[model samples]
Target: MKYLSLIIMILMSPSCSISKKNASVVKEKLIVTFSKGKCLGNCPVYDLYIYNNGRVVYNGIDNVKKKGVYETLIALDTVKRIEYLMKHFSPEEIGNTNGRDIPFTILKINDKKVVYRSTRSSGNLLKINNLIENIKDKL
Candidate 1:
């Protein structure tokens, strides 16, 4: 029994040390921001910020369900999924078109940034819109 206990402790020590080492590696903060412009008709204009800690802030400017600043906490899993999506996003995946009246989406992933403006609606914009709605629903 003594030998068995010693062997178990020895096996557990390495994993504990490994986990501590991994925990020491600081992860970069993830932030997602979305903003929209006014259109020809009544369009909601808002600026939203989502942090890795699951804190979200939405500033509604005009024609929105809620006006002024509102803050809420989202699920950590949702934040992780958003981080994954932003990290994998590519500028080449979305094309730009001339549309002055349409809303523009500015997505920033860490230090990288992309502005999306489409005359004819695209899948990327739809994805972003859906993300915005999801975040709002949580709030």
Candidate 2:
């Protein structure tokens, strides 16, 4: 009888799997767009945020910092743009990420997107203009 009680106690303990709480965390994807490194024209630096729930948030040019940091929510309303960004940028930079994937901050889109390449590949400026141009076709 005592052994049965001990087994029951162990099963009912806080550390038991039945007592554990399920995680409520949700993963999200975000894209940060740019016109120039430091703002050169009317092209607004856009940041498109994409949620796993099919929801999106947009941050336009006005909210962007004057020095040139920009980000906004990606619009699901336009599947063309979303598909373009995901298909191209994913293989080029890091795909539809949660924004913590890369190190460098100055994301530019003038002639091309200059992603900070890794040190092993010489850490040099990896010019992705061609890829961007190809993606531009889809846009």
Best by lDDT: 1
Local distance difference test scores for all models: 0.72, 0.36
Segments of candidate 2 deviating more than 4 angstroms: 1-22, 27-38, 63-139
lDDT of 2: 0.36
Candidate 2 lands at a TM-score of 0.28
| Per-residue alpha-carbon lDDT of candidate 1 for residues 1-139, written as tens digits (9 for 90 to 100) | 9999999988877686777878754442448887776788887788888777777899989998888999998888877776676666565656755666777666665786767763443454456557667787666
Pairs in clash, predicted candidate 1? none
lDDT of 2 by residue, 9-57 (tens): 9877776343344332324333423222222344334443334333444
Lowest summed lDDT across 10 adjacent residues in model 2 is found at 117-126
Clashes of 1: 0
Global Cα lDDT for candidate 1? 0.72
Evaluated at residue 66, the lDDT of candidate 1 is 89
Best model per TM-score: 1
